[model samples]
Each structure stands twice: as structure tokens, then as C-alpha cells.
Target: MSTAPSVTDRPRRGRRPAAQLVGIALAYFMVLLDTTVLAVAEPSIMISLHTGVAGVGWATTAYTTALASALVLGGGLADRLGAYPVFVVGVVGFGAASVACALSPALAYLLVFRALLGLFAAAIIPSSLALIAALYPDPGARGRAISAWAAISGAAMAAGPVVGGWLIAVDDWHAVFVINAPTALAVLVLCRTPITTTRRLRALSWLPHLGLAATLTTGTLAITRAGHRSWPEAVLFGLVALGLAYGTAAVDRTSSAPLVPASLRRDRAVWTAFAWGAAVNYALTTVLFSVPLLLHATATAAGATLLPMTLLVALNPPATGRLVAAHGPLRPIRMGFVAFPVGLALVAAGTAAHGRPLVLGLGLLLCGLGVSWTLPALVGFAVQHAAPDAAGSVGGILNATRQAGATVAAAVAGAVLTQDRGSGTAAVPFLIAAAVCALGLAGATTRHLSRTKEAPVADHVAEARHLGHMSRTSDGSSGELPGD
Candidate 1:
């Protein structure tokens, strides 16, 4: 087995560690801000580009599909090339793509640029997580840093709609894309400090990556096409997606260095984290999409209406971090699962009750609280349990699942709404989202109770043994130490 350089062994540059953390968080913030900003600007974009509803939806789908598909590769690249360099390149590429998007004269050009944006976003997400894991070796400090990162994402979600709406009103839809340039540039400036490099792993086969991309793209298209009542097209796409999934699995089982390592695939905690992350985004995005439709509000009004919920989302993470520090990750995560579904049920009830703003707002408040509490815990747990050398890969899997959840949200919401455009139909999507949350809650509860029953060190040691076995099975290698 090849011994990689440890993070502690690397030399530090002149910048303070705090500054490095902030720079990484800011980079993540740009991505989050772009997502919410686009949500608000979709209608304006449709109008400006003279496109139909389907075309407008593609703008979002293209980016998300590309992002989900490319994530594992990004993780692999980060682990090989060093997270700092990968992150820097991603930010620069993202900025250029954003500028291209702003300048696009046609809808096709816009779509192309948006896909490029996703490619870069895929790179940024995993690299940032890997860099954090490397920088803060202490578990407590790392948990807090991850929490802060989650908090910044929440802040971006809160700000995006309001900011995007105002920008659209003042200038045009292009202004939303234009804003990312300076933000990315600023992050680039802050992250000038040198980062320690690690030895690159042997090149993995690209077949799994290709299959993953096909699966994501076809799966998303199938669902969205079904929403539009294009049954034949949907069926064809669904078949293709299924075939790709099978092919990917086959490749994973045979490859010496799979995109998702065997050790990670065997960890229940990692899967639990992935599921919860996906469920949280599924519920959140469902509400974010449905409420706007249910109210039939203008972009500005929609932004205003959503403000209270997102503000809570932004503000709650620091306190949640303190909770994690004191009580451990499971408590807040469990709480989030319960609250998320309850919040969705309330939203469904509110929509059924003729769109009462107060009722809707109350539901949204719970949703925000749920997301704020759960997100940090989910990230912290995943990183903590993962093999230290594979931080970027683990991060990739986690974020890929989350992005897939978002894609599912878009497809499900689109289908439900297209079938029944009435305000009352909003309840159906929320109820579906609630079901997804309940499944996540069940998974979390099982893991939490199981952990409670075992001595913590015993559990860790068992997991280590399992990882060791997995590594040996994969390629006659020993496992790296589990990260705290």
C-alpha cells in the first residue's frame, strides 16, 4: 500500500487558519447563492429568453444532472491533485461560466454555459470538504468548521431569492449570473495561501463515471418528461437510466479502485448520512418550489414570503453546532428528521386550506429549523466516519446523493404540478416529500439507537476492522486510519 503524506506533515503558509476556513466557506457560499438565485429568476429567464416552460426547466436540470454525474470524478481528482488546486480551478471556471451565461444571446448558449457551471460546481464541492478535513485535524474544531460551512450555505439560500429578485427588477435576469463573477474573484483572492499536496492515486476506469452521468441525465429526463405527459419518451429514458445504473454497479464490483470505494459502501453511517442529506434537500426544495406556485406570487413577493423561513435556516446553524459539540451529532439529526416531515405535513395542510399565508409561513419556519439542525450534523458525521485518505471521495458521494435528491424534487414537483395546476395540488408534492423524510428519519433512528447500545470505541474499532477487510478484498491493501 502507498503511504500518502499526512496533513500535519505539510508546511503552512503565512495566512491564518481562520482566514483559510473563511475562504473555503466563501467558495461554497457562491455555489449555494447561485442555486437559490436561479430559483427566483426562473420565470424572468423564461420571459427574457422567449422559451417555453420545459426549456426553462431544462436550465435547472442541465446544471443539476451535470453536477451529480461529475461529483465522484471531482472527488477523485481532488484526492489526487490536492484540494486547494482543484478548488481554485473550479472557482475560476465557475466565474467564467457565469460570465458566459450572462452574455448568452440564445437559450441554447445559456444551457451550455449552465452545464459548464455545474461541471465546475462538482469540482468545488468535494474539494472544499477535503480541504476542511485536512486543515482542522481536531474533531471538535472540524465539527465547528463544518457547521460554519453549513451556516454559510443557509445564509446564501436566505439571501438568494431576495437578492436575485431585486437584481432582476433593477436590471434583468442576466444580473443574477453577472454577480457570481466578483464573488468568485474575491474568493480566489482570499485563497492564495499554499496548500499541502498529496500523492495521486492510480487512475480509475472512466466507465463508472460515464455510466453515472448517463444514469443521472436519463433519470432526470424520464421524470420530467413523465410530468409533461410524454409517456413514450419517459419510458425510453427510464429504461436507459436503469441500464446505466446496472452497468455502473457491475463496474464498481469489478474495478480495483471504484469511484465509490468498497470501504465507504460498507459503512452504514455513511449511507445514513447520505440518505439524510438527500431527504433534507428533497423536503426543502419541494417546499421552496411548491409554495411559490401555490401562492401564484410575483418573484419579489415570493422572495418576501420565503424570507422568514430562510432567515431561521441561516441563523440556527451556529447554535446547532454548539448542540453537536455538547450532545453529539445524532440528537440534532433525529430532531431534524421528525421536524422536517411534520413541517411538510403542515405545508400540505396549509395548501389544502386555500393558501393561508400564516399557516404556510409556520410550516416553512419548521422546515428551516429542520434543515439548519440536520445539515451540519449530517456533514460532520460523514466526514468523521470516513477513511482519512478518502475524504474527498466520501464528500463526493454525500453531495452527489444530495444533488440527486434535488433533481428528484424538481422532477416530482414538475410532474405533480403539471398534472394539476390548481393551488390545492401543492399538497400532493409536500405529502410525497414528507414520506421521503420519514424514511430518512427511520434510517437515522436505527443508527442512533444502535450506536447508543454500543461502546463508542468498540463501534469505531469494528468499523475500522470492516474497512480493513474491504480494502483487502478490493486490492490486497490495508485501510487508512478513520478520521475523527
Candidate 2:
């Protein structure tokens, strides 16, 4: 077994440790909470907005698309500027947009503002991860911090429904989003100390990234509108296809600052990690978005109450996440891989049985557990292998994969689930999720996770030998202890 660097001499200085973790964690919690609350409130939004399936779907997709497209830029900008200021901007902007979403009079207005929210919210994850990377310079400490970070996010996902449900039950659907404002403001108030930092120009171009976003946006619109007979729909589909093709070409030609970093693209471990992370997020988002709708649709169709269905869907996230932490990411992820299909099968069986809420909830819980398990591991792997100077770039790419993957999944699942206009559509998304989880499992079994233990400990010396790679490759240069 390769030994890690000596623990006593790792770099651990310049920032208050608890402050870094607390500030970043609070920021992350708000993001996760917003996503979860929105997921459960989808049914309420559709009813309140008097919109069709497309309108409800856009509520989630808008945030994800904006978030994914902006993440890399957010990270690079943070590096160029400073994390604290950028982070505060993201917080205040997201909080302000939450108000916009809450007070909007029309679906269009809400979506426009939601997109704005996503743009600013995009800064949070990359900034938080980069801050953590800067603050905790030791690998072991960083890993543990990430694990805690993941745990907090998982907890938030679990709590989303309870809070959303309470608000939707007692107050209004808009209140679900409105709650973010005060919480974010409080976090911002606490984070007033600005760290002095300068922005660095990344070698990559933004055109390819823009192309990638255009591809996803257009592709979603194409898939969603596939059933329409209108000439406008056809034009949209054609445009989407063109954008996808253009994005593909752009990625192939660019070596510097492509949507995906060259390091991630070139490294199998990193690339595989990216693919798995995308797949997991895609499946998770599909479930989060679709399951509530399925339950409500079933309850409404059958003239049953909505409470039972809501409760069951709500339980899956936190419950499964806690299970994942206990069992380790692999077992839960594998189980999630296996369990997702089981949940889907239950959904299929339940839908066939005319909206059995218990079965549906059980299925969702299984899927949620699987997602929580897989996501942390993928994130952990990406951060673990990143080159020192490239932490922001790596974090951005990984987060982009997550947001984009979830966006794609949400789009495809929406397309699939909206077809029948019945609760049976629930089975469609569940099936797709099952397929995604299976793909994740197949990828997991490949050499990636197993190879982690065997990676060279002499990587620091090897990295030092490479051109332009000599600055602080590993710990021990600053006389600070690891895990301090």
C-alpha cells in the first residue's frame, strides 16, 4: 500500500478553520434546501400558476440550466476576485431572486427570476469547495471536511420536504421559496470578513461553455416539445440539434478552459468520476422532481388525500442519506444502484395498482438513498485528485457535471413522464432512473474506486518534476500540521 505524506508537517494556516467550514456549510445548506423545497412544491406551483406540464417542469429546469452554465465561470471569477465577496454576492443575489420567485405574478416572471437565481446560486458550490480547498490544505482533513459537507447537503435534501410540506400545508407554495431570504441574509451577515485575493486568467474560453449550455437548453426544449404539431416546435427542435452539434465541435477544438478542464478530460479517473457524478445527479433530480407529481396526480386522479403521498416522498432523502454515511458511500451507492430499480419496480407496481402512496414513497426513498450515496463519493474523488492550483477549475467542472447532468435527467424524465397525462407516467421516469443507476453501477465496478488506494504517494515529487507544476504540490512546505 502506498503511504500518505507524513501527517505532522502538512500545511494548515492563514484561515480560521471553524469559520471556513461554518461559512461554506451554511452557504451549501441554503442551496440544497432551496432545491429540495422546490422539488416538493412543484405540484403546488403548477396549480397556483394555472400552468400546464411545461410550466411546472421549467421551474426546476431553469434553475439547473443557469446553475450549470455559470459554475465554471463562477469559480474562475472567484479566483480572480476573492471567494468571500463572490460568495456574498451569490448569497445576496440568490436570496433576492427567491423574493422575486415568491412575488412574481406570472409563470414567465417566476422562470426568468429563477434563472437569475440559478446564475448567482451557481457561485456557491464552486466557491465553497474552493474555500475549503484553500482553508484545509491537508488531504485527510479536506476529505473529512468534504464528507461533512456532503452530509450537511444530504441532511438538507432530507429536510426540504418537511419544510416545504409545512409551508404548502399551512401557508402558500410561494412561501417555500420565500424562506430562503432571511436564512441567506443571516449567513451573509455572519460572513463580513473579506479575504484578500487576486483573480487569475484561466487559459480556457467561455464560448464552448456557452455552447454546452445552449445545447442542453435547446435539447430540453426539443424533447419537451416533441409532441407538438406546431411548426414553431419543429423549428425549436432543429435549433436544438444544431446547438448540440456546434457544442460538440467546440469542445473538440479547445484545449484551454474548455467546459471540461483538460486535466479532467485527460485523466480517466477524473473523467469517469465526472460521468458517474452526472449520472447520479440526473437520476436524483428526476426522482425529486417526478415523484411528488406522481403522488399528487395519483391522489387527485383517485380522489384521495395528498398527505400520505407527500409524507412518503418526503422521508426518502434524509433517511437514506444517514444510512449512506453509516454504511460507507460504496455499499449505499451499490445498494442505491440495486435499490433504485426496486423503487422503480414498486412505482410501476403501484401505478399499475392505481397510486399506492406507500409503495411509491418506499421506491422514492430507495432512489434517494442511492443518489445521496453515489454523489458524495464522486465529489470526494474529484477533489482528491485535483492539482493544487486547479482546485477552483476542478470544483467548477465537477459541479457543472452535477448541475448539467441533473438538468438532462430532469428534461428527459419530464419528457417521458408527461406523455400519458396519468399516474402511469411515474413509471416512465422511474424506469429511466433504474437504467441510469445500472449504468452507474457498471461504471463503479470498473477500475476507478479500487485504484484509489494504489495511487502513487510519490505523486508530489513526480508533480514537481513536471514543467510549471512546482508550487505547493503536496503538504509539508508551510510547517503546519495536518488536521489542525
Task: Give the per-residue lDDT of model 2 (tens digit) for 240-305.
Answer: 668685766567466355565444556676677677767767766766676667655422222122
Cα deviation of 40, candidate 2, in Å: 1.7
Maximum-TM-score candidate: 1
lDDT of 1: 0.71
Question: Clash pairs of candidate 2?
Answer: 80-199, 158-318, 204-256, 204-257
TM-scores for every predicted model:
0.83, 0.77
**Cα lDDT tens digits for candidate 1, 92-184:** 999999999999888999989998998898888767766776677676676677656555544676787798778888778899999999989
**Candidate 2 local distance difference test against the native:** 0.61
Clashes of 1: 0
| CA RMSD of each candidate after superposition | 6.3, 8.4
